[model samples]
Target: REKEEDGLETSPSKAECSVWEDLTLEKARLELNENPDTLHQDIQEVRDMVITRPDIGFLRTDDAFILRFLRARKFQHFEAFRLLAQYFEYRQQNLDMFKSFKATDPGIKQALKDGFPGGLANLDHYGRKILVLSPSIIDRYTLVDILRAILLSLEAMIEDPELQVNGFVLIIDWSNFTFKGWGLGSLAGSSGAEQDGPVGQMWLAGRNLPMSDVEALYANIPHKDVLQAVRNSIPDTITANLVAELCDFVLIHSYFRFGDNLYLQIGRTAMGTHMAPQYANIFMADLEQRFLSFCPLTPT
Candidate 1:
């Protein structure tokens, strides 16, 4: 069939045909980008490659897509695989370096004295544990779009959801704050929100969170919006309670740690990366409006 497809003038032997099949697979694997539509191929393509052409699917790469692909294979969690791959790469590199250590230059020797004091390798268990703790949620676009999508997702939950459970949860790890905005500066302690505000926003897609989990997916997903949407989706009667508690917690935690710079950092620099008074404000505002309109005349 393959030979017929290839349109060979004369048929090759069985061995040659098999070799051609192997070569075709190799090319397909190596030239993954040659066909843009190839990425849309089902998981079976990946599974077939894994079994018949391990070199095709498992070709080494540290890219996020590769990490995601591995996770989707049902082999193990992506973060765990990431850590293991990192360790494996470390082992290979270090082993190679040690083998060549005798001949390395004096400057290089000095730089790596005692296997290097200032490398990611020196990080302790606690630090490594933190690094592997949370999966990355990348919402790669303008902060405005991220915010809008989040807002809408919360809105959709009510317009959607079997359980009618209006729980919008945002789990912000410290990295979200540290995520250097595309055109935003990187002075080590900067937050993305400091540069802009919700005013004059063009569209709400990026800013709004998706109401349905099934609406979208994780690749470049604005997972941050999920929490924002939920916060905004809450009823006004309960909105004040939520804000009071969150704001109070921030103040208490801040005062305990940094003393006076506590309030100064609010709305300007995030305490953690993703923490935001603006987010709290908008959510509560939205919720309050909803409650005022819908809340029963008889108070609960």
Candidate 2:
């Protein structure tokens, strides 16, 4: 069938074929606007930076390893380093998560049964991976285990060249979902809530935590301590909670526009970036309303 499709003389020329055949090259051009040599040199520089940073570990010379951080920070060396450092720190703080996690693990398998988190069978138009999660499918299980399952699945997909260059999309199905499933009220006592008021805004999807797990973690942490810690990280002029809310936004500029459901689109910014600040603000506003309505501000 593929041969038949390609056999037509009306088909694209050799140059066009080559262009489509090598998506990595196109991704580099589209996202970074850099030629092959330039991208290679930049990757080398980023690799060197990661190696020299005494605070970070598991730093590899591999293109994929370096590109993850570089793409996440839009190739800004300092910003990428900060995010990379945070990634390591977060993993270290949660040691149990990385220990022997694999896609075939039983916990992950069971979580799959719950539809706790599921990866779609296809990529998006740009060859990026698509991950779908329906909160309605969650069963009576611990959030951490479910999160581990999801991460294991994502880790399995991370090495795909298409996904590496193009990145991923996360679609959260809010249809039939309510405050109970969202666990919004649960954020009040957590340290994150004291600072950010909700987990939805506290953590970036890929950078720090799985969306659901982070949400639950924020809901349950000691709010007072969390608030103070987040406050210390920001300038004195901004309210700590406000700063906390904006922090994740600064890290992740692309977000889903909330309406009947939520659809979030993300890709490598270093290539061609989408800076949807206005959409993010609108989404944040809707999120705030949800928090206020479902999770009222009462003394935790």
Relative to the unseen true structure, what is the Cα RMSD of model 2?
14.3
lDDT of 1 by residue, 127-173 (tens): 11011212122223333333333333333333321112111223345
Residues 59-135, candidate 2, lDDT per residue (tens digit)?
35577676666766667777776776777777877888877676567776678776667777656777677888887
Every candidate's CA RMSD: 24.6, 14.3
Going through the candidates in the order shown, the clash numbers are: 27, 12
* Candidate with best TM-score: 2
**lDDT against the true structure, each candidate:** 0.37, 0.58
At residue 10, what lDDT does model 2 achieve?
54
